[model samples]
Target: MTIRFPVLIALILALSAVGLTYEIAAGRVLAPFFGTSLLTWTTVIATVLGGFSLGSALGGIVAERPRAVALRNVRSALVATAVLMAVSPTLLGLLHSWGVRGTDGMMLSVILVFFPASVCVTLPSPLLAKLAIEARPGREGSSLGFVLAAGSVGAIFGAILAGFVTLPLIGSTATFAACGVAVLLCLPFVRGGQTGTPGTTIAAAVFVVFAGLAGTPACQYESGLSCLHVDRQGPEVRLVSDGTMQAAESTAPGEASDDGTVGLALSYTEWFWARMDRDLGPDPSVLFVGGGGYTLPTKLLASRPLAEAVAVEIDPLVTKVVRAHMPRAAEMIARTGFDAAEGDGAGRRLGIFHADGRVYLNETEQRFDAAVMDAFSSGSVPAHLVTREAFARLREIVEGPVYVNLLDRPDGPLARGVHAILRELYPHVEVVHGARTSTGRTNVLFAASRLPLAPLDSLPDRYSPARISDARAFTDDRGWVGHR
Candidate 1:
């Protein structure tokens, strides 16, 4: 019996949509463990493409077989893909629970979760092309065009729907499961690709049962941004992102001391107190760009009682989490009433604005005595912020000094490029790194100001700049992405 070309076309479209969704979701799935960085994207993309290529080759070889044989292969491929897609997030979740992290772990997760499914998804495209050739003999060119166009349209729809709707609503784990179920629905819509024999059915059932038992992507909280990785190692409550601990609190029964400095566990958090020689204007206002776990700002509120502070963090969920769970932040907010709204305004002691740092800086009239910029992830710095224009904007808004904590090598392109950009506006710019600092991230800080240099040795073990041969300044138009 001949197949309806239109039915095959529609199934192919659906398959294409799911294929792209899997590819996109793979990156997000691996982000919490791997970090949503260039390297991570590159790995996911490369692995996905490799699977597609492998499937295409296998499909091309099988397309020479009889029509009945082709349909059997297609049937098996679709069912296998559905099973794997359902389990991908669960597999990643298991790895996460096992404390697997970093590049190697991420690659392993991608290979296990994504590669096989991608290969299965691509198997049908070549088979569909050959089947169409038999259905309509001389319409080879049109068959190719129609199939390719349908695939593209469906992929676009899948990406948009997954990103804007499914992810924001049901979350990553459920989204993966739903996409799998969607692919299964297409089997009925297109005729002839029926379920295989009894043993195959039992095997599929067994996989489903096992996958269901793997549990949802394990996390304290999850969003399109990042997973809220909460860990209780001992007495400490930790919030980690990308295996880099953002904040930790000492919470234990019958805790003896209640000093303000207990939460400043990382050197980077303590570095917020390290200031320049020049005085901030009277009644000083300070700005913190990113409030990861609210550790630094909490420390500042407790230590610098006289200085008024303003923290602008983009993620409201993160702000909410810190205020609710973190002990020191909650206690400090309660004591000062800083977290409360003061007549449609932020508190004087510590005003919090949930907004992008650059946008907040551009709009706010309040000139800060100091600004702490902790926005950039170690692997992914926003292109716009690293430019000369951004530095200029900071120069205009900040009166005293602007301190930037960067996770870059002293001689790396990022450090040198940012150094050149800082020199564009500030008369005096100094880069320092501490050998044994509180921050375990091992980041370098760039102190940019329009004044003379202060005594560097005041802070113990501060690593001075190594050397600069021929550094280049990053501008808004020129140097956003190419710095690395």
Candidate 2:
């Protein structure tokens, strides 16, 4: 059986799309456990590229075979690709449950779950190219060029569709299954792949459907920024973003404060508000760099009722998830008329702007009495948001002390680096933590101000001052990237 040039090129494009979709979705799937750090992305890219190179080598060997065998093997390879793509999510879950974590675990997970699928997806490309060449005999250079261009262009489409469309629309698990289905669909259109039995393809399709159905979804809502989910622990409702608990509040009777009022759940927010209470007046206008679950912003509006606050949350989906799932936060947003669409036009009590914190800071002319740098990507502050240049601009906009929340090992480089940068700009810079031991990762807060700050010795044995003596500062040119 002879394959048409157009049909063969279409197959190449579609398969390339599925392969790149798998690559992009791999990052999202690993994010919940591994925290989409620089290391995670680096590992995923390396593993995928290694697998593709190996598969292309194997495909070259298959291309040397008789046409019938080569085409038959391509069909079998596509079937394998479909199976692997569909089952990868479950495989990742199993690996994670077995205590797979850290750099080693991340590397292992990517190699085991994604690498084989990458290999299978590209294994048929050489064989398809051979068919394309045969269809147009002496136009070898043009045929190869078309194949190469189609594959590259298809990858671009897959990346855009996965990042902006499928992953956000249907979620990571479903997206993985869809990629498998996409590869399987290409099997029917391949003209020369004369497989005697359709039994394997049918079996693989059934298995992909079963795996998709049986797999538990990791997130309630997935956005380009983070995986959003809600969890209930007793009466406390917690909002998790990218496996990090962003916000929590008690809902049960008598679980509120002694005054019958609900307050902040996370300890860092309490520290932020404590500083705000000491420095700012009741009607103080505050700027929040990151609005995770909008917890602090909601609390500010509830307590002051008319406190003008703007929360620049990067992901609108995060705010949407909080409004739908977390009742307490939702009530405060509705009460304050905090519509993201209004964009500072209507509600001054609480304005919600969806944008990168640093970009918003650069663009806005509005000034505030104080600022809270509560924004984070996974466990660490986004590199640009933590740099010396970023803080220099922030100090200009915010009149009083600027509070920053970070997660790092006790006196880790990230903490020390950020502290070093802050010291260069502010007259008074201090690092404090609630943890007792100088070990492991803990929430470290940096309070930098033009004016002298009072000792944060309020809570029992909390806010222990950390010394920052010798450390390199993070700048826009040399930004912090990895998890410490």
Candidate 3:
């Protein structure tokens, strides 16, 4: 009628491992919806720890019950948690497919998919501790410490296994289903927990496989780095990252106007010509620092055959998908690395490099006539790249105009702070508010150069003259845009 000390510690360890495994799986589940940003991670950590804090406190109270009753409750909690795990992937995947977008969608999905199981999985930890202490009455402190430490170590293992092994190798469905089955392993340790019947375990295993079959997450591509989602509305095909619309490309083709004005699907990209070398003449070697949809590069190459073009993208999977969408440019990316013969000398050619923008800029010997930075959106700009040191390096690599397209409000830290930094980095800085009305703006483009910028008038809806000055400019030590 007594539980063994080692067996009780093992059960507690399994319980903790299952808890952390589910947390990692929750991140993968939400990646296509919330993105894997600082904000998203903050939310995940809070949600998980919050549930555990509650469950552990309640488990302490449950420990006062008769041993048989507490063990029965532990078995029941494990079963319920596993059943929810089986259903979660399909349930959340369907929610995502039904148009879950932005922060609200992320919170809703987390509440549905993670909150219940997180609470259930930890209920047995304190209960296992109580059982162990009762079995070895004089060694209570050792029993508690050993059981608790065992749980923490198990969590560490679970996190590593999820990231480096299971999630990538088997995908989210099987990984989650496997975690659910692992949760059931703790049930055998429930004292008098089993009825000596295979019926329930057999049923749980079937449910795991069946739900896993239903659990394939909606994704354009789910890589170790990201989850991509593609959406099309009319001729505009947009690439979405972490639920945010990162870039848009129009399938509808158009030529330059009679006056030599270029056409583009996104107004932000169109702003590139507002003060760029491409406006003055041909064969200007241009570097595009972000490759979201490769829309800007595609636009540049199409508009000027003599334009030397290069796009540096961090995610090769994203690049590959967008390349398929832009076959000619994709062909160029695959065939060319850094230097290629200009297309018309025979022609100006484009080369793509799969590297981080900062690493590429620092490492590449080539100096660009102009450079475009569309690498980041508002909340998740790479902190290291937003600093003063990064801008100084960019100024070195780009001898002419450098245009930075930012999806931020004109007055926000990203637009305002970066605007201030550009003036210090380059002599002539012009802020082009791409989506501005008299009321406000959300997308701002910073054009800077050592030379004079071309005369540009504030056009209605297309672009307007804008500026912001503030005490905040990002540095490598300070960390990130939009963070105060």
How badly does each model clash, as a count of residue pairs? 5, 0, 5
Candidate with the larger TM-score of 1 and 2: 2
Q: What is the alpha-carbon lDDT of model 3 when measured against the actual structure? A: 0.71
- Predictions ranked by TM-score, top down? 2, 1, 3
Candidate 1's C-alpha runs over 4 A off are: 1-6, 89-113, 129-146, 193-195, 209-213, 216-218, 233-235, 249-263, 276-282, 303-308, 331-351, 359-366, 378-380, 436-441, 456-470, 477-484
Q: What is the overall TM-score of model 2 with all chains considered together?
A: 0.95
For residues 213-252, could you state the per-residue lDDT of candidate 3 as single tens digits?
6666546566655567778887677778755667776555
Model 3 compared with the native: what TM-score? 0.81
Clashing pairs in 2: none
lDDT digits (tens) for residues 262-321 of candidate 1: 545555544445553243544566778877776666666665667677777666666677
Residue 224, model 1: Cα distance from true site in angstroms:
1.0
| Candidate 2 Cα errors over 4 Å, as ranges | 193-196, 252-260, 340-348, 436-439, 460-463
Number of the top-ranking candidate, with lDDT as the measure? 2
lDDT computed for candidate 1: 0.70
lDDT of each: 0.70, 0.83, 0.71
